[model samples]
Target: MANNRNTSFLSDPALLEKVDKLRDLNIGQHVPLPQLVVVGDQSSGKSSLLESLTGIPFPKDQSLCTRYATQITSRRGDVDRVDIRIIAGPHASEEHRQHVEAFRMPTPSGLKFRQDFANILQKANEKMGLRADVSMANGTVFSEDVLKIEVQGPDEDYLTIIDVPGIFRTTTEGTTKDDMVMVRDLVTGYIKDERTIILAVLPSNVDVATQEILELAEDYDKDGRRTLGILTKPDLVLEHGAQAAVCDLIQGKKRPLTLGYFLVRNRGPNLESEDQSELDQIFRTQPWISLPQDRMGIPALKEQLGSLLFEITQREYPKLLQDVSSQISKCRRDLDSLGPSRQDEREQRSFLTHIAGVFQDRARAALMADYNSDSVFDQVQLRLITHVVNITDLFSAEFQQSAHLRHFQNPELHEPAEETVSSGEDFQGSNSLGLTISNLQDLLQATGVNDITQEELAELGEIIDLSHETTLPSDDVTSWIRDTYLNTRGMDLGTFNANVIATTFSEQSRKWGDMTKVYMSRVIVTIHRFIATTLRSVFPEEQSRRHLWSSILDGLLQRYKMAMDQASLLIEVERHKNPYTLNRQFADALSKARGHRITELLRPKARKDTRQYGELQNMVNLDDIAKAAEGKSNMEQQQEEIHDIVRAYYQLALDRFIDNIFQLAVDYSLLHGPDSPLKVFTQEWVINLEPEQLERIVGESKVAKKRRLKLAKKIQDLSSALKILKI
Candidate 1:
């Protein structure tokens, strides 16, 4: 075996200088580039093969000579020879420089272009040899240097040949294994581009068609063409009489192999003439191998590589086009099968109305049951009466001690004017009405009751008696409480009953309202998100879901918060407690249950009374509502008015649960993009399901085989629909 300590192209100073120039030039930008990766078992002639191919013998010391990845390129004008450059990890940089410098000293012949490289390395080595032992922060010791060669052929096609450390030796050390994995990934990444080809070199004694090699060959063959394999030390095979057997193995078992193997003898002047003739015959049989006896093996291999490279380049063009076309076709298909159109929206509204009616019927039945069992309203009245009596008892002493109440007992109360304001100014309103009532109560307290006349006292007594007579008994507080809180709450909860009925009713009502709004908004937003973001991610489009979602969420939240705040302030002024504030707090709690935003709570409700009007408007096929108002068209005006009313109703509903609706929109977008194949399939299934089956699936019930069968039928229907749409 060769001493394995031999250093060749890596030591060439001229090549090193050329590598620097290539790096500075940035040749990676050029088109039709080739990445040539060299892979083999340790001491299996990987570097030797690269040296032979690139006309630059790489160092082959038993100690790892190549560590990390490296790149070598020729100077732009120089096509005949290459420049060597090293690519090392951050930790290996200093050590690699030293090795590169040491190799450059006493550069070999025919490396005239790398004269500057030789001087630079010599100078660097002499100055920094001591610092080479200085380790990087990472634990990895810089020991090996990978040699990269960039060859520019006469055709101006650039080929990058990477000479990696052998894989087998890497397993011996944990660190080495890590390095090997990284190197493998790097090599794989380069080769996966489809423009690159891997050249695997095997020793003559080793089997040419080992299972491992076959697997490697298959992986390397992106275009289904076996990588070129070289059988080095052909003379050894000739002496062992294994040449015919090797040939049989390669030709018969590895029948699909792209390039045939060649027998190469590395021995220089000592090789015999008879041996040379035998080598020539072997070369003749494997015309793919370029091995010249007169010249160094480097030139011959380079020539052969150039031809092989040209063939690979020709194949890549068509393949790239095919990949692009396939992607475009997929994008077109996705665009055709997206969510609800105008017709779909109308149908969905109708469906919602039907569902609402069902829920209302259930709610009325539950209410009747409560009514039959001492009625919620009656209980509420009794409770209010008891509360009034309790309040009177609590403040009875204060009422009796007030002399101002006695004097003001018969005082006339003035009402506000009934005439409408006809001023040009807009209506200005305040909470003064409540303040005025409070002031009147305060006046009665300040005055002494002894100042009042007997007639006035009799009138006050009669008023008090009337109030007490109108109030219900304390025993009926339950019915009154039910009327005030539970009935209002039960409007949405349907037949559900529990203790703390009012609180439960309120909570359920708020939850359902938010959920419904969120779901509806989510469906719409999901479609938008798919169109705006998801499709772009999958189809190489401009916009992304992340960007779209971020923008939409930011904008929607800002607007919704502002609107809610204003609405809350108005409600607080009118009702003495901020409704919007309470709604927001409720929404926050509801979101915890749903684990999502509740933006859908803001969607406007369609008017039930305007169903006929909506149907008539739909028949008119108005493209734009604004256009309908032009030319004094009464029907168009009426249609516009109806639309405005619908919009107002929608706005009111949305105002009640904006957070939920917005959240739903975001969720919908995330779930229905082009990249969301699962979501798309799910949506398709939902759209195709029978009405009853869909209801069951969406409802709380869990039916197994029936559900599965229904789901399967839905999928089938969706598939048929998609087929019709050519999606």
Candidate 2:
């Protein structure tokens, strides 16, 4: 019971202020406010029930029916009068503001009610600009505008309800079929709000299953989650001998909803002549009413509704925090987009600085690999220092260890200054001897010498080449014979293979260049979007912001191209020629690898080579030596040499390439290439502006201004609501 006492806290006047103010701010739009939505067929005692609840003297003229939704929101106040305040639809441009002010209905201090409800309705219709316009057949026949009736008194319950205009089955004289659709649509709109508790008022004279509103309610709330049934004409049920079924409905039987039905014999046409006390007495003691005191009459009805509202409020108050928070966040973004509303140039300059500093902070965070931010929109696909650096490291490791790199031309080895010419054409441990043999062959081919007779001519030619070579030792003679034998057979063996390795390596490494371009594009786009979004926010005026954006966008693009070209200029030097790289470690690694492969290939023929070569003197043909060569073309040996040379330098060039790529990406696309977003928004003279101009010249249009005010006010109202609902 003590825990149940918390319900009284919801009825606090502070909560009422929050609800009332929020209602006025959104004007029944945007955020869905919690309330009861009363639905019934036309003249089904909907108005009579509202009049009974409020104890207000509503007009008896049934002709002046409710044309729009009448939202009844009341709290316990000292005043005995009803405040009739009209909240026009958003589309009712002319009357929205004027009608929002409360029209107080004063009554003398007595049980006698004021008979001026008709005049008030007439005034409401006139204010809505709907005088006699119901008959006009222009298809847009109705409005979502609501007339709010606020009754404040110590005796009255603190409750909120929306009594929508009755559903119509047939077209009236002045109205077409559209009016029937209009009223239903209007009713459905209020009932559809999940925050609303549906009070479906079905007359007892009609079958509940046949009502279209009942079907609609069932569809919205399957198994009756938030719907409460109200049997308005209980007398008709008793007189017609259907009290047992009606009582079953009231006692939670047929069409059972989560909240069971309540029965009430409405004070119908004579509602204004009676007070709430008389109606209460009739409901408790009158046999004609024929309902239990707990489930019937205005008093029980008030208690049930109040308890239901408290239940709804308690269930949904936590969501109020979320709703208000979301609304505040959304409005803040919109308002930020509209930029700081500067009173003059000084504030405008300050605003520009603030936005610039904010962007700078975000960019620095991105550079430093901090991606977290308050704004949901503030995000990057990859941090410059995180993913890019990781990718760079990956590239370097893979490239350095690539199989394509066999070796490189060693700087440690050099060509001799002179060549030795002799019969002993020694090439053992000598880099220069190969050239001496080359000259001998050149002479033989050039002089047209051939056969045994030309063998002397070859000697003569070779001796002539002797002057070009230095002397050699007798021990080297054997080595020279083997060298001459090997050289005469083939020359320039591996030249083509080495050229191919260089070309392939050149081609493969260039792919990273294209990837660098793609990475740069992402960075540029991230910064570009950030600039446009943030700068547009500061300018506030759409037209001028767009114009400024377009102007600066062109300049930034041009600068981007220039920045890319500048970065490429540095990379272009490396692209044109391979670096003169000297990697000593790669030389040792390549030699060992090539030797291992050769040992594997030649191991099978080692025994045969030793036997055949040992018996070389008795050999009948050159086939033994030829076979001993074992496919070792001068071209292949040269190819192996070139492969080793290329392999050694591969790592050095790759490391340099990767480093250059990172530097280029950071410098050209991220830092000061096209002037960072932050710098672009806050710079000397601030681009496209004169010296005296403090900010971008822009205009705040009428519509933009209105939207700004509405959002701000709505935010204010929600802020209050959230504060009150915090408990």
Candidate 3:
């Protein structure tokens, strides 16, 4: 009854053939295929079991043990046919693939097919360059490549099993410790795949704990959900009085598995018959018969494996289709990024021309401030015009804050104050100097200068902030200016020498050149970033992009240096050239400055007490005003006038300097001119390149070629798989 039940669902041709077609397409190499993989230690009857399942002869001797993974597939067909081939390993070079592909054997039929199987394997071994003896040390002892065999006959069952090299403990002749590790890694590689159902074959005569395959299965499938334990050679265990232990394992009393265990008796050296009756007869005789009847024969093992494979194939088919589709999309996308191949000079030039055209358009857009065109422009740093304007504004504001050598403060005032006179203010009369001073009407009225207006004081404060202003304090600046005025007093009396003021102005503006260089560097960096981003988008391949950069960057940098030199020369001329301005605003600025300073000096003489004057108006002291100017000489007043002239000229120069740095240096050298950096990689430049230069810049790399071929093959195989799956 048990035998009849086991043979009923042993083969399902329709479903199994679909999977066979997928495997034949080599889909398993890229993605895991639903199948059973047989694993065991050496001398564990693993080969005999495969022979029982496939009816093809496997080498039974220890010397001819499997040196690589063998994929044996048997299914029903009208005529008997046997085909063999090698699937190259991942690391196999092109030369090795050719050798593997060249291995062939003559077609044989009937009894002759079985007879030629061993010769076919021997030829395959030689083709793989495996050594014959452990001590030879000439050829590799193991390979990662796989040997695939397909057998078709009317009587065959629909089954596929991958048999890996049996695990071995110690090294033998011609084999070293490396071979052991290689074999272990090779076996574990197949068993660890989640899609494969592991078939662990163990010899019942040996202790089950000693079997390496079982340990590996436990490591990979700890819950034993997809692992099946097969105990072979129950007859040998009977002689050792270990039948009870084997029975315990079969009955789930020890080392139990979710899929349970099965006991099978295989053919001995003297017994060459392959039959389930022989196995049944031996189990019926004694203690073996006391084990579970349903789990004791080869037929039950085959039945269980068939059901498991069918179930897994059905469950994993949808996911397998999705995986194949995903791989196809990824491969095609990678190929697209590589662009079309260019083997010759004309093709290389054409490809480079296309890239250069794209670069030109992007750079033009950036220069024009049209940032809506490309996605790369989404980064704020890459927006050329906006960033340049922002940094330039910051440069101008910083110069306004720190350009002065010293900040002047009136010593008589309660708080430190800056002159707040506006250029629009009107002055009526002239003082002792040649400057027109405001508030002469009040001086003539003998009330000194009237109270300073809020509107007048707010004008200079609007242009520059006073709270965070940076410079030397009043005491240091006054002493320095006074000492210089006395030392340079040549042919002048009651006034400061003009050279002292000129020399002071030159020293105060020394920081402009260094600041301009830093500004230019920032602009260069921005241009380079935009160029690099354009290159990445145009040439997705790294090697080609690097070559093109080398070809064009020298010209761009030379232009930058030329412009930089011109800019530095402009600074040199400005520093050494006489301080002169043709603009008429300088006089108005100086007059307002004098009015503010004289008002501050006169305010100390006004009486703030309401008893002396009214609440809004202040009474002036003529004696206090004389003490404010001088008792014997007018040198302090001369120093005050000199300080006012320098302040007015510095403001005029700062405005002109900022404009020159942006327009003359950055715009002309890097962005706008015919030979500017933006014009370095135009289509005309590509056409002008010498043939050798074109090849040097655009030649395809070996790694890129290999990658293109790999992706192309992967896309082809996956497309075929999709068709086979009927998706």
Every candidate's lDDT:
0.37, 0.57, 0.73
Model 2, 1-727: lDDT tens per residue? 3135335744454654566666755434666777788898876778778876765555545446778888776677676656666776655553466654444445443243335667777666766656445555432345566777776676666777777887878877676687788888788777887888999888877778778788888877887988988888765655544666676787676778888888776676635466656755645544435655577766677778877776676666567667778888898898877776654566555555565566566556656666675352343332434444433333333333331212233222233111222112232222232333334334333322122234333322321111221122223322332343344443444344233444545543454444444444434444454565455434546675665565455456655555455446655665556546556666676676465445444444444333655763322234443455477766445544444444445555555665665566455445645554335555443533552444344434566668777778767766765665564
Who is ahead in TM-score, 2 or 3? 3
Candidates ranked by lDDT: 3, 2, 1
Which candidate has the top score in TM-score? 3
Q: Model 2, clash count?
A: 20
> lDDT by residue for model 1 over 1-727, one digit each (tens)?
0111112322232423332332233222222234556666666766655544444445454433444444544333344554344333223444554555444333333355344443433243233332222232333422333434444445332334555545553344334556666655644544455565566667877665552443555675744453666567654564334665655534534444555544454433244234333444545544224333322244345545545544453445354334334434553454332211112334543443443343333223332333343243243222222222222221221221220101111001122121211110011221223323234334333332113346433423221111111111123322333343434333332233232332322322222222232223222222222233222322232222233233234333343333333333432332222223333444543333222111111112112343675553222222433343335544332322222222222223323433332333222222222322113222333345565543432222233333343334334433333332232
The reply for model 2, stretches above 4 Å from the true place, is: 1-34, 59-63, 73-79, 88-95, 98-113, 136-141, 152-160, 176-182, 193-195, 234-244, 268-293, 297-299, 310-549, 553-682, 685-708, 722-727
Candidate 3: regions farther than 4 A off? 1-14, 132-138, 273-280, 290-293, 333-375, 404-508, 521-556, 579-652, 678-701
Angstrom error at residue 207, model 3: 1.8
- lDDT for model 1, on a 0 to 1 scale? 0.37
lDDT of 2 at 563: 46
How far does residue 406 in candidate 1 sit from its true spot (Å)?
32
